[model samples]
Target chain A: MSVLLSATRISKRFGGVQALSDVEFSIRRGEIYGLIGPNGAGKTTLFNVLTSVYAADDGRFEFDGAPLSGLKPHQVAARGIARTFQNIRLFANLTAIENVMIGRHVRTRAGVFGAMLRTRATRAEEAAIEARAAALLDYVGLAARADDLARQLPYGEQRRLEIARALATEPLLLALDEPAAGMNATETSDLRRLIERIRGDGITVLLIEHDMKLVMGLSDRVLVLDYGRRIAEGPPAQVRTDPKVIEAYLGTGATSATRAHAEPAPAGARPGAVPGAAN
Target chain B: MNRAARPRSPLAALGVILVAAALLVLPFALAQAGTAWVRITNLAILFALLALGLNIVVGFAGLLDLGYIAFYGVGAYVWAMLASPHFNLHLPFWAILPIGALAACVFGVLLGAPTLKLRGDYLAIVTLGFGEIVRIFLNNLSRPVNITNGPQGIARIDPVRIGEFDFSTTSKIAGLTFSGPIKYYYLLLVFLVVVIVLNMRLQDSRIGRAWEAIREDEIAARAMGIDTTSVKLLAFAMGASFGGIAGGMFASMQSFISPESFVLVESVMVLAMVVLGGMGNIWGVVLGAVLLTFVPEILRYTVEPLQKAAFGRTIVEPEVIRMLLFGLALVLMMLFRPSGILPSSARRREREGRQP
Candidate 1:
């Protein structure tokens, strides 16, 4: 019921391009927050700022009631925020389970000496790590391929493996960037179930997805960005009816025509079925 | 779990015994060359340790460290300064070895801190400079301080001695004569075993997993909550410590310390060993080290003699020809097997995907 994370006036610029400007939103705890926009909506830039992958040019973030500004990516993760890359940047040379084990690194206590000597405590911790990593693989439906190299896995499975790896971090906020980007229909459904299952476990999720169907289906609340700014934010039904979101997705010409037939729009029974909501 | 049980299997146990027997007879079998063969074997083991250490950084962590030999030099010089008569200090080997390793670890962290932001070729160039910096300091520190003895090098450094037994001297035990080089062979063998086991243990551990993760994708590793800088620094320090231990052993075994021994070429040789065998594979590194050590010697022995017998004169300098052949072999290997002769299983999988 409380806010898990919030950004205030977050802005970032890359040389000539203002990647994100005055973007702001709050994600409630135990909710799937969807971020959608046309191409280059600065959604990923916002994620980068939230995770401290990039220092925001303006503004700050608060996570779990503490300021989350200027922390390194690893430090942000250690504070219970973990993320997956949009393109599925799994540790390609590592085994499926090892990728997940790396996610548990911040939570583990073994050091170089402990690992080298394999002391009683270190051994026990390592065994626990392996057991948890295997469980995460099973959670993501890749238990049978635990020993397979990550790069060797098929594309859809690699995306799932990335999720499994992120889950291993014991994150309070799991930020997935384009998790369903390359999933087939079945995989997308599975991913939707997995995201719901994650929320069922009481963790907040920030999802950046182009698969409109999956986003509308899973997200409790939705935020729409256009060119670098937040254009709309609300429950999906309300957001889908926002003319600003419509103009951003379908451009100026379509907006005027669609606005004339506003009552005829049906508020888009399936948001994915709305012509202007393809993004 | 099965890894713990592997060495105890009957077949593996037999393989272990046969290897032990072969190693025991190795020095004597090659003793016909009047200790030169045994000396070569000792050097090979030392390089194996060096290669294994480099593997920690360049292989597992995917950080190229060309200055790795600097730590080896640090270890050797620390041992020389503490145990040799030049300093009028005679610390026991047990006391000096840890000091050597710790000193090298500190140096590794020092180098790693500044260079942590750099990756791939930039890291390589900086590390190369670091290696040269250490070597030049060793070369010039004789002035104003008279330390390192400059280019003349330090001589008569103490050999590894345990209690009443002096490893520097030849001893006859159970009718088998154990010369200095022969004793050194066993000592180096033990150290090499320790290093190899240490590497193998590290390669499968949590830190090792973090390292491989960083090597594969630094950004993703960070996103997963890995402190990339510290993990990278650990890799540098771990690699340096191994080099330090080997350096101390080298100084003690040879009873001398010299700057010429830790040049960029030596660093390149160790790096080559890691790549030649299999970057992340322990046995592959040892195999590469051994082959590189002996291959030159094999060429030295056979190439010139055959050249003279066939042509009644040498067509090219044997040294140049030796290097030319070595370079050619490496190039061919890269073309055919970019990963190395004995790649880690993960790397083997990657290679299949890459070529396919």
Candidate 2:
């Protein structure tokens, strides 16, 4: 597969605290690359840097072999990288379809005068955008609720709707903050299949997920971070057995804080422990 | 099926027909009542047009523009300077109106370009400052002497003419002489209709959505690849252009121009109209403007006579009571319906959905 995106030794700092330091990441075209880390491990900070929400203090990112530097978030999006926020950030007043249609702004060329006059070209382009938005909504299983106000949707549907909106941009590289977050087993499995199908369409998927099953099962390769620094990187099997990965997950400040405050699961208990997992 | 899938109401069609009927017959009805009343109706409609224009900026785009009246002032001054005996350069009114609109649009961009990045309250203060500066400049331009007539103002502004068909008393058209309030009333009505229709079309366009997106969530709007600054400037300029057209019409109708006419109070009145009716909703602003403009005149007739008859001394002057009531009404409405009487559908839905 071709390299869709590459971030080389990216470092970012907010005031005196280092957010990301010497982190190298890349996603091949048509591959699902998972970024896993404990909370405050700079996963989101890296996403922000790549999307140009926060400019990196050092290092550079290139998309499709074109260097990305000093571009705004909108400009980055226009360059075909689209992302969904970890916390849903939709225009709540707009309808579900309209939310997706807004993503098509870069693609639509109708100006003020053409819209005012309802020129033939503008009407045709508007129709085309509507169709494409509808198709994206369908791809995310939201075609039935296209006209509903986005805020009115149930939580899981709202998450899917956000993905649909991002997809409406027709991005080659899709960055999902957490696609299986807050979902039951059935929903997560369905999301897994859907994400695979998205990859089948030749779009590179860069995802930040806490679901270890999803991270290990679906990702072709996984990159692990501890305290804003790269700790391990490999395929699921190799990374799973890596001592650094276990120490980072089980010994880090995040896991220790939770363990110190909350009731501990028994030793040898795995994170996504289902009913008969010990067998 | 989605609840939002419900078809758009035919209320728009009903509204159009009703408005057309009213515009066609209201002048004739008022002419029968009295010439002064007919003239008042014309003035109210002119103000309504101005209010609608301001609404596009303040209401729809969520930009609080306090200097909106400056565009109208500029338009009136442009007409006065181009077509009045004060300048002795009598251009046709039709010619001056377009020029006035273009000039205001140019000024609108000039003001908007530098300030589009300023958000919320800062924008309001900047615009307010700009309005004061314009008024002061116009008031003190007597050094040029031949241009603006300074504090004395300009008078004897010529009526609009269209191809040997002057709207003046001496001019005749199609074997019938055009004169008095009725002619001007019909003319203003036509302009109001055109503006209202254009507003309706604009509110549905991609540009309108871009404005709303900016209003709703600027970061999200910008992330969607919209150039927020350009979208904002377009809204301000288009809104200002409408004010300019109405301003030109006001100059020709009154045959007078003054810096005092475009004061801070005038801007507030236009804003009050938008609030009383509904922001982002064109017809609501129109309704607000008409009601607010005429209610004072109606009160003048009733309050003065009632006070004179009852107390053997004037209880309160009509104008004072009218102003007091108007202020009280606005305060009460703001307290009761902060979103205005006819909130935009998108806005209404959002508010309703926010309820626990």
- Report chain A TM-scores, every model: 0.92, 0.90
Expressed as tens digits, the lDDT of each residue in B157-199 for candidate 2 is: 9887777656655445577544567788878888998887777
Q: What lDDT is obtained when candidate 1 is compared to the true structure? A: 0.87
Measured against the native two-chain assembly using Cα atoms, what DockQ does each of the candidate structures obtain, in the order listed? 0.59, 0.37
lDDT string, candidate 2, A159-188, tens digits: 888888778777888899877778888888
Worst 10 residues of 1 chain A by lDDT: A263-272
Runs with alpha carbons beyond 4 Å of true place in candidate 2:
A184-187, A252-279, B1-18, B144-146, B168-179, B309-312, B346-356
Error of 2 at B189 (Å): 2.2
Q: Residues A25-51, candidate 1: write the lDDT tens digits.
A: 899999999988877888888888888
- i-RMS, every candidate? 3.2, 4.2
Q: Determine which window of 10 residues in candidate 2 chain A has minimal summed lDDT.
A: A260-269
- Local accuracy of candidate 1 as per-residue lDDT tens digits, B74-140: 9999999999887888999999999999999999999999998999899999999999999999999
Model 2 achieves a DockQ score of 0.37
Can you tell me the CAPRI class of model 2?
Answer: acceptable
